[model samples]
Target chain A: MSQAVADRQETEERQTVGGRFARLMDMGDGALAFWLLLPTAVLLLAIIVYPVCRLIYTSFLSLSLTSGLPASFAGLQNYRDMFADPVFWSSFWNTVIITVVTVPGALVVGMALALIANIPFRQRWAFRLALLVPWALPLAFCGLIFAWFFQSDYGIVNDVLRRLGLPTVIWFNSYAWATVAICLTTIWKTSSFMALIILAGLQTIPRSLYEAAEIDGAGRVRQFFEITLPLLRPAIAVALIFRTITALQTFDIPYTMTRGGPGTSTVTLAMYIRQNTVDFLDLGYGSALAVAMFALSMIVTVFYLRMIRRGA
Target chain B: MKYGKTVLLALAGAVSMLPLQNASAETLHVFMHSYDMNLWQAVFDKYEASHKGIDIKVTVGGNTSEQQAQYLNTQMSAKDSTLDIINLDVVRPAQFAAAKWIMPLNDDLDGGTKYLDRYLSAYSKANVIDGEVAALPSRADAMMLFYRKDLLKKYDIDPPKTWSELSADAKKIQKQEGGDLQGLSFQGAAIEGAVCTFLLPYWSTGHTLVDKDGKLTFDMDAAVDSLKLWKGFVDDGVAPKNVAEIATDDTRQDFQRGAAIFAVEWPYAWNHFQNDADTAVKDKVGIVALPAVEGGKSATCLGGWQWGVSAYSNHKKDAVELTKYLASREVSKYIAIHGSLLPTFEDLYTDADVTKAVPWFADLLPVVQSAHARPVTPRYNEVSNAIRTTVNAVLAGQTSPEQGASQMQARLQRILR
Candidate 1:
């Protein structure tokens, strides 16, 4: 073709692109917002939606990686097997027990820390920084550290108990004690995070409310219960939801410390899922367990949301 | 325009360096447990030095078998080609072979059966699966009874030959060394070693967890007796009350620090006890076979690592060659001298250098030869979990030995089925 014809074709292409740009610029706010967000929406669909769908689909199959059998659809067989699995129930109860114990334990301890840190002081920033240290530490690192700290023979806890002339308790040998150790570690690791969030909420409370309570002749405890606790509901809810979800998915501490030991006594749902998928190579059953865990988390989230809405 | 020229020149230079990166050499990546990274890296470096144009990149995985297996499982499941060679624990080869994640060495090793004979007989037997060699032994290990020789001598007790004898000896030693002194230390945690802890006594009772056909040959009476033996120790204060928390390293560290009278551990601890600067038990530790049940013969759990060429590896030829070299008698002897790692080759056990460096290697050969590799099956992980967890439960006092045995039998049947 001639150079002039090529130039004309390029102009036409530029005009079309310019026209599309012009149209986009002329769009309404909602449509423009959607167009701008489409990339992220598609990305979310690919990464999050696809895997979740794959998980659900895989859960219905009998795809054992080491079984040397071809992948075949098994309908509800995986779920059926999981329901009958004694490990599933034990892990489920373990997860539930951990969540139930750790959430409140963290909230109370976090509130105490937040209240302590919130005090008007010259080195409040340093105090806050120190409070955030546990929050920033890696979960597995915390687990390992606590595992050593609670070591039956040379551990500091038993050593102190022995020094104090008290009978030393074995922290990780029995199920109840192992569970307690795990809960203590989880609370220690997570309470700081909860405190940070609750501290943010604590700062947001108008001093006028506290002042009014003080003027009404309220004591420190009464003011905390009446003003601080009531006003801190939203922050507490948010913190609780985050903490509860993570608590339900507890893996690191129990794994590093007990490895769901003392007979699967402290194996959380997440650890059991890993045991199936990674250790046993039973992907189908693992997926089923994962889906159950996901459903449980979703139900808890929904319940919290509904409760929050009712409160509002 | 002048600034644009510099930017373009910089971009051109960067692009030019890209090919230089690829032009270096063929890289063979090796994945291994972190416990002996330095020793393995030395072996790899030796291979690299000899075999020019080949770069061996080593990826150190976690120390525990579970941790190593978890990482490899994910990588192999994804058909990751980046990892060409993997060092697997003894129990993992069957699982890895069943998953088809590793290549069969029969064709590569020139009809691998004859090549397998180069290693100790048990390791040689373990390498073959369904008439194919799945992996070759890199080292040899077996659970051995490590005792305080000085303490036993001071207390006028010989090495215990049976579980009851061991218990009595431990109690006697503990009584004499009362303050903060424990009788025994062994792995009771929910780790791979715990399976051995359970199997040691069970095997002593003349029972195997599985039959020749990989069938569940779990003897309830024997298993219960085995569990009861461990529980009795914890209950009677022969072992620590919190024995369930002890892992492989815990036992080693406890015994090394002079906190325990005896430790049930692998051969690796021999080096640490005799060489480490802080070891209180150095020159005082003695190695022997694990104690048997009252009327039964002595037994131990076999352990060691094996080398496998990944099926997904792009450089299978190079990887196989490296594995062949690593599994050779020359490297085995070197490891024996340098790392004090037991050699897979039977002849290396008697080699003058190995015997001089590790005098007990010659004696360990017989124990290792007779040591049982935990029921070779694709479902060995599940089998291990069943036995280890039930053993832990009995030790933890969560269930009676009878209940634990029954639970284990049920779990094994389901797993085998």
Candidate 2:
């Protein structure tokens, strides 16, 4: 009875502190809040907002890299030209296909690895560390290694296939398979990152819950679907968000491996923007493409956030 | 009253010294890419030691065409006088000249045209647009055939004199050598280097990207034949199926590792092939011109960098002097020996000391003599990209060469307008 009274007193004290804080906010103590946020706000404004606005503004103008003259107002012509450009549409579709393929594939594989790692075993630590090696390696270095591995003639991949009496695959020449090869590299490099996140989520579920489910005649698979999956929703959503964003902006691997192809087969949206802005030096058109990419990313982000909220 | 008078006297004295300050503060700022910074520093040091009273501040940008474009555009747009001199790629001088961001050398500076004429004929012509000499050639590079002399001797095959001979010889060598060694290698990737090395054979066969009237002509049968020949190597198994993905460096490394019998590359590879530490074929490599197509003529594509004065420069005279110094024979020889850059002057190719130092130049000069520049236009980048895309499509078997050529022509026409 004394302990219960002590708990009630503590609850009342917390409520009183919260009430005072709410009253301060109601009385326009927002100034104190603004002061605390001012530095971060300024940083975001300078780094993010200003550059985006400038890029959008530049997209509306006619500019060339060679001439440093102020761009004349081009209005919507640059955007219109981009729509007519087959390279832009092809790369946009490529980005979508890669994102769609790699995201779900990574999630499934990641979850499986996480479950395997979560099981108590003699070498669980070793298995977990080994799984993370792919993720831990720097992306550009991995890309270089993949470039060598996929070489059609001298590469180990082709050599092994040839020895097995299988026809050699020309990785960069075949459009469909080249894209698959690139996607495989991305999935290999990124699945571990997702697995790590899922593993953390898996650890958070109580062992007593599983024991109770087993006592209630629920099998391991059924318990996983009914309880474990529902609890892992937040972690899966976070993984999807990160993987989708990264896959959408995939550049370095394709760049280092195939360089947007034998015939622009694997040119992602990021590579398209880079080629136009940097290689071709059409800043206005490049900026317009950048704006399009920015808009697309925001839409996807908003959709993911809503899904996460509904799942919660 | 006395304190106020004393303060006014001091201010007056400081004001009187302002002219001296202005006179002594003259400095010319130069913006160059990172690769050229060291060479430029050497040249600048020499200049500074000999000529006093002029200070130069150097800034290095990223070593890419994109970084160069950004730095030039941003700095020039701001009317910043600090970015006085710019180092430009071969294809870009015409575009920059047309844009008027760079000064018209013949009109703005003294002895510009005469100084430019000292460069190789084709290189000098690359910088001229609308009767303006916009830049001076600083360095020159042309593609050459690098072959394994040891492999040739062991296989009992002589250096190929023509395209047909090269193909036949490559096939024979590939048949005999059972290991990872391939017969021939070149850049077939869909990038700038591929176009540089492969287009030479095409151009030598009298195929051109554009005509005199700026009309697109790459859709001709010769262009298709050229594409077919380049793709033929992969189909015949003389070149690897991954040839379409091999970069210039990759192809060079393959030859250096004795995995390839022959390679089409630039002079830079000569030094690498001769370097004992990196190459298995060291002291066994031979240089030759690209073989002629159809027992006819041969050509090489010209690749190099040039120096130009920015139009926004406040110190035009100083910038011009610096450019002239860079183009001087002494500096050219210094770069050849230390920097491994090929000189653009004709005399340097024949100089006994230079030939003794490089040795490869004796054979490289003949190739450079017949080297062709890509179509010079304000829209050359667009044209070059279109050609590369279409050619790559053909090479990858995504489209027929004839269809790809027609598409390239259409794109070229659109850009030319």
Candidate 3:
């Protein structure tokens, strides 16, 4: 009977040991963290990383919706064709123009508005709210509004020009003019976003700096140049980066307005990619073009990150 | 085991009867490009009344063909079954049908159905891609040359039957009219409308993207001449340079305002030209088939919308029924008269009510009968884009006609390969 009792105790001891081992495993810090983050990690893998990697992989294949079979490896033929394509190069230049013009154009307007918002005046909040109206409107709606405002025949812009005894030029017929017009529209809409960011930066600057500068025989412009300008650099850099990216990926405004018209004078990389993939169904070539665009965007991002870091 | 089997049988029976019970609460959604919404509303009203307990909701998705196609792509590419019916542009059937994005209507159209024979040959052929009738035509339109009848009468000129004649007449009219009135206006914008505008000359000259031998047939001399002719409109001071930015509606506006003596447009502009409050030249507009070039024939590019059933629709039966109802002769006649659209039904052209109501149908019927469909390939959108870009280049003075033709041929070859 004593031996039987000992055996029962031994069995109980082994059971406790097993349970403790399992509990120890569960208590591991890395294991707990992994379990906690598994869902989000899986989600990112499925949606973002998977699609991106698959696109990169697809760039090396001869797959098309028309082929309807196992995809063949294409190597670098698509890239070769893309590099040699005149349309691609021309569109790239167009994208560069849109970006270069819109970025600084918006920045100047935004900086001016930000300074105005920083003014210690009555109804300052109302001014800020009003400034944000353009930014808050949907992009497509803004495009339509601008299209109506700039159309050649009945647009208000031409009407005003004619009424004011100025020459009425067709806004979207010529290549250079169409680009300039769309860039101006982009700047008009996006300037509000940049202003809001700069306004936030403006508020963070200490009042003491301006006051001290003013007391030291510095004019208002001098104070702005020294204190406000230097302090606002980081915010401007960040805003410029976002604005550049937005310009690089612009699709809706120009699409809705002119549809990359005047013989593809405004076809950006995104539109080109869409034309090849969605419109043309040339998946392989489109994926190659898409990867190239992603790489270009990455370069721009890296440059901006450095600029932001240096400014900060 | 017996109890479980009895419960299983009961569950199966209940599930089988669920549809019948829910039939009274059936609802359907139809997605289409926005045109005349009042006509569509009336058609839907009659349908809803005829079928008790079935409610239909109509959604106007997009305004232009490109926007509509893109919107549908966004919704349906992910196998979304939420949309039961889709109204497609005529050029969309080949692509959509080949992608299996739409359900084939062979079974529905077969079995002693006279519906297949009722539409014009071009209309019927447009819906059938790869031996499958995947959509039914709902509306029909054709590119037409609208000239000011009063201006022509004053100028003592018949409607110009050729491009050279039209150009010469336009010069004479512009010189005589001489007060903010230009010679001609045509859509040269870099959109789908531009493709249709370009195709009129290409087809009228007997050149096409694809020939009978399955050859890339874009390298014809007639095609090159057609491109040059379009550019000539600008160089010769006929169409204004700003026409390169004009869309269809803008062209119609200029013509209706009497700002131009001639306009190349579609039939949808007829009612507006005749009835708009601001119409300056009402009852004085006349249309003809788009003029041909020397040693070639005259033709018009067909433009219209079709109804396709979504392959993934859960309500296929209801969708098919609705499609048939929408394409019926009675309904087509009603739409043709009320919407100011050409009827897809063959007999509607002769229907006394329709003919009497429009009065222009008698003149328009011949043009509609000879309307040329765009390239019926699965890559139609891309092909059409190439055509538009090429023509736009010539018109925009970016490329010569010969260079544009070669570039078009090369681009089309690359895409088709």
| Number of the top-ranking candidate, with lDDT as the measure | 1
Better of 1 and 2 by DockQ: 1
Candidates ranked, most accurate by TM-score first: 1, 3, 2
lDDT per residue for candidate 1 within B13-99, as digits (tens), equals 999999887767899998987766787778878888888779988897788998888788788889999999899998888888988
Q: Clash pairs of candidate 3?
A: none
Q: Compared with the true structure, what per-residue lDDT tens digits does model 3 show for residues A147-235? A: 89998889999999999999997777767767877888899999999999999999999999978888899998888899988889888
Residue B220's C-alpha lDDT in candidate 2? 68
> Whole-model Cα lDDT per candidate?
0.89, 0.80, 0.84
Local lDDT at B29 for model 1: 91
Residues B1-417, model 3: lDDT tens digits: 999999999999999998778776577889986778888989999999998767888777779898788777667657788888899999988888877889988887654224567788778878877677889988888888999999999979999999889999999988887776778898787778888777777887777768744457774676687788889889888988876767888898888888998898888898998888999988899988888887788988888889999998888998899998998888888987886799887778888999888987877788888888777777777788888887786788767889888777777786676
Angstrom error at residue B48, model 2: 4.6
**After superposing the true interface residues, what Cα RMSD does each candidate give?**
1.2, 3.4, 2.4
DockQ of each: 0.55, 0.24, 0.33
lDDT of 3: 0.84
lDDT of 1: 0.89
Give the residue spans of candidate 3 off by over 4 A. A1-48, A61-78, A108-142, A153-166, A191-236, A275-285, A306-312, B1-28, B37-57, B111-118, B274-282, B328-340, B343-354, B358-360, B363-366, B393-406
Residues A1-312 of candidate 1 have per-residue lDDT tens digits of 999999997778658978678778888999999989999999999999999999999999989998777889999988878887788899999999999999999999999999999999999999999998999999999999999999887999899999999998777778888888899999999999999999999999999998998999999999999989999999999999999988888999998998787887778899999989888889998999999999999999999999999999
